[model samples]
Target: VALNQQPRDMIDLHARMFKKHGITTIRNFDALNDLRNLSYSGERIAEAGLHHQIVITIMDLPPGCEGAHTQEDYSKMLKDILDSDIPFHSVCFKDSSGTVHPRKVYETIQAARKMVPEDMILHLHTHDTAGIGISQYLAAIEAGITRIDLAMSPVSGGTAQPDILSMWHAMKGTDYTLDIDPLKYIKVEEVFEEAMGDYFIPPESRMVSPLIPFSPMPGGALTANTMMMRDTGTLHLYPKVIKEMEEVIRVGGFGTSVTPVSQFYFQQAYLNATQGRWEKINPQYGNMVLGYFGRTPAKPDPEIVKLASEQLDKPVFNEDPLDILEDGRPAAEKKLQENGLAVNDENVFIASSCESKGIDFLLGKAKENIRRKSTEAAKAEKIVAPTTVASADSVMGLREYTITVEGKAYQVQVAEGGGNPIVSTPVPAQKASAPAVAVKVVEAPTPGNILRLEVKAGDQVIANQTLLVMEAMKMESEVKAPAAGTVVDLHVSDGDTVQAGTPLLSLSS
Candidate 1:
């Protein structure tokens, strides 16, 4: 629906292609917001003779209601789908934020089982964001949910799904028993733990966070936003951003804070905190308010809608937004050809669906430029033989002395026969002087790969303008200008690895 150009034929093609690849099932969520699109996709999946599972993500917070419908509303929506002859194979309750209480899970599932057909399968998918996902799954199972999703120990917990081993242990000697070897899973856990190494987030840190119920930011977005704020030296303002997020969700109409919706809320909150409330609204948020994305779960505040409409200079679109888009396949093919790329149906489709630069990099048409410098020290070894050989008539004695210079030790040997003293060469030290003009060196704030350069040598820039973007610890950080100046030198290129305090560029007034 975001693309707005392709019709149901695209869905048909996708389903058939997946079926050709030996895929038998497809799962989806967020159908209420895009019921028309999802229903169309479901029809195509049914036509392709594949099983389709539609997941209803459940959240219980009052503030979260702005972004999602209530459990009863979700049940009604599910009934509508079941009655539509859409050939859905199952219905699932997904707790992406892991914020649903255990009791609520049991009650929600119990209610859903009554609404769903007895023959249809019921599944539960959840995360461990708040560290209660395993209990939630247990509740869901007791409520007649047959399928539950879990992850291995090393990859599970924290922001990820619950551990399969934990579930196995919990279900032991119960009616909901799992038939699996615990020892085999233990081996798998060991292998993955060793493989993940430094990337692993210890289980202890994945414990329940008290702030999640109030903030409701997904794990990935929260970490990314925190890193971004820290990199920009605005971490102190993060609390304000979180407060603004609640306001944004309320005024912007409650869209589920996941994926594109989550991103919209996060961006709007940042803007609201930094640029004043509603001073600058993102075009996507404006469109969302205008009903361009789809019918929001709740109507946006009239004042907010009016403000967005005035900014966009267009009224809210009640009809499907797909009606306004023109087919972009031809243009996509032309663009690929212009770039000297071989255009195929799939390639053109993908190119049209995503940003060109990102697609080019993913396709390896653009290469990453990185330079490696060795920092190893050179070592020299020397051997000296006696200057005079001992004879039968006379014996020569030698003495060895150790001398230290600049903390480095050296060994010297001398003959007792008054041989010239073994003397070492002395080098004069150079004096340091201050430069006439101070050069402002911009250094990296963290170790990361330079993702892109926003400025070049001789480019004039103002204070706080982003000079580059870097990726570190799986988050993108912007390197901004410290003061207004002309870029005198660039020491790193895109994809260069840099450490904290590594000089990246130089600027002069």
Candidate 2:
């Protein structure tokens, strides 16, 4: 959380003084990147026994806007802030620029919710310039925000939120489990109304979040997410951005980020769109952090906007980028082209998707699609092909199997032929096994040794459908299917090496 906002000398002075006085301070860090500097600040915070707070600042777009707050820049900033460890007790998304859209705000908060844990408090502070601030507040509530910063006076043209009455009413609409009472709120507001007559009170705004009914976005405590997405104009590729996030989480990773890293993720889309190149990730340090920002789009009804605007005595603006050209004034793509990042015949760069995902996934997808295409194709390529169909049927007990793995090949010795099975090879037991009550086949979870076959070919199995287990990572993961399928063949015996993306066992359907 040690920041590099002001001059390094000033920070050094503070650090020295803080240490000398034995103060338990919270280091407020600006740049969450810059490892050498971040490390130094982290060391200082640790030595002082202070909690570090991070507030990642978004990069101003090359061209400045009078008051536009860019969500993309905020996203990048938040991404970078969470990417590094600074003993950050809390993170705040500050709207240094007053321009922010309601929809973008909703999406940004949701994305932030996913980036941080419940224990980590997220905060937001914004200057209202196009009047979407109240909408942003409502979006925060729906997006599961708990903490916010409001000023006593209206900032810029609009006011700081949580106007006692408005916040109290909004809380009533929310199912949030905050311990409180609205009657106390009404009593306080009555006293304030008498003391400060005609004090400005903006009405409660509509939700600014995108409608993600199936899987709701998480954190809304900050505007860093909103600023990050909007700043980058990432609202355009909203779905893809969220998709990358889900995939990252699936791989046991989180999408907490920093500004520079956020820029890296969307650089091709913005700065170098025509170049078609992505930034390289180095695992030595940043692998554990960085990448991906998302949000639920805000959908505030115009009639509602009109109602709120009239109440606040201010004009409420639409936050959707599509509206930029709603009257055919200018399209976002056209704006990009105007900015000189558009693709032309000259600036084209070579790119392909297969490089990162590998040919296997693509081929697997194509195979499934082709099989599903037509009955003729499906007849030729089965969804789950039986060993009899995929290969010539081998004898039940006597089958010679050789497994090639990695680059080294292993010769597997299998037991063969009834009474001859006992002393010839590995000791093999011969039994009738309940007349094939259930012919369950076991396959490898990942490519590894066969280890041990818990059940024989003709053994009865319950509905749970477990046959064999494989060892991967550090623990033993199970490989199970249904109990009804016929056990056609066991490819390898115990203690045989295998490769990933390799099929080890075949079950008859």
Candidate 3:
């Protein structure tokens, strides 16, 4: 949607590439549980001779919100996919948020087993975010699921798929058994740990979040959002953003808390906290509520629907999403030709799917900044102690102090004779000064990293025109010109981090 890419061409290109790369199976799913969205993709996957595992997304709605996301709702979804023209070799019950109860997992799979063919496979995938991975998996196995997704240690627990060893141990003393060695997984983990030792793992990615059920954030997206917040110096807003999501989900048609939709909820919640309640509706969220993404399981709240229609300046859409998008292959090829890049199937798909970054890459302007152990150590070594000497006449006994630099706090003890002290001069007091001039400046609405500056010095801008784009809590917001004026000076550049009320640019009326 960001690139306005056509679904048919993108899906066909990806399916052929997967088959060429020796991938035998692909798990296909839509976050909204819209079968119409998956029908064409599944057909293309089969055309490429790949086993397609059609997914039925599942999640538990927040307390006091109902009529959707229940087991019955999922069963109906399963029946729809079976009843549709989509071809698949297996069915997966996917709970991205890891909030579904064990009973629900068993019941959903049990109901699915009855509807699904005996020869076709039934798969289950979930995370351990809420400490329910084992129970949920066990329930699915008891319900006769054929396969479950597992991961190794370090990347295995807390905001990731459940660990192989944990499930292996859990299955012992039961009729079900895993065909694997626990010690082998231990050896594999050792290698993985050494390989990833330099990468900084956010603390939230390593612990169970008790509030997950209430917030219903996906494990896959949890750490990614936190890492971005950390970079923007807005990590403190994480809790507020998560808390605001409860209401976003309550009225967001209860689509399963998975990708695209999950991101929409998070983006909306973050905007509500940083940009005021519903003051800035995330375009993706607005599109979803307006029925651009396909029919949500339930109708979205009427008020929110109206708000989205007004803010996005789009009428409520009721047609299939794929029907509205134009064929993107020709546009992508034209973009490549315009940039003097070769147009091939791969290039067209990349340009269509990746947007501007893909164009930069094709032009050989993309920079590689992969993190390594030595780079991390270099960053730590860059922190230095204060070098400026305190004035001798300023204070007689100020020896201890606490200071924070670059997000790290330190305690320092100043000695009496470290460096040469400058002499102090006293000036006579002056009369009351006149009030300072009231300068007009555009300021950041919240602490965030500047994505780009839309205006330069001496550029004329109209009121409400975007001056820059800022990303805070993983949501992007435009910093608009407060009034029509000529841009006098810019205080920040691309990728600069700023706090709330920091002047982004000065404008002269």
- Count backbone clashes in candidate 2: 38
- Cα error, candidate 3, residue 209 (Å): 0.7
- In the range 356-376, model 3's lDDT, one tens digit per residue, is 557778888753435565564
Given candidate 3, what's the lDDT at residue 74? Answer: 88
State the lDDT of candidate 1 residue by residue for 1-509, as single tens digits: 22223544455656776787798998756522567646777778877888888766565553544445566666766777777766788887766667778987888888888987787799988777777888898888889897898888666777778888998988876788777898999999999887766452433336566555565666555655555444444567768887787788777767666555655677677777866888766556777888877777778889988888886577988987656656666676787877677776555555555434435654686543221122112211121111232221222255545566886556566678688877654333443433545458776654446777989988999998989976643435578887899887777777666544466777777
The TM-scores, one per candidate, come to 0.68, 0.32, 0.79
Local distance difference test, candidate 2? 0.39
Model 3 ranges off by over 4 Å? 1-6, 367-492, 497-509
For model 2, how does the per-residue alpha-carbon lDDT over 290-319 read when each residue is reduced to its tens digit? 211111112223343344344334443323
Cα error, candidate 2, residue 408 (Å) = 99
Query: Rank order by lDDT, top first?
Result: 3, 1, 2
Q: Which of the two candidates, 1 or 3, achieves a greater lDDT against the reference?
A: 3
The top-ranked prediction according to TM-score is 3
TM-score of 3: 0.79
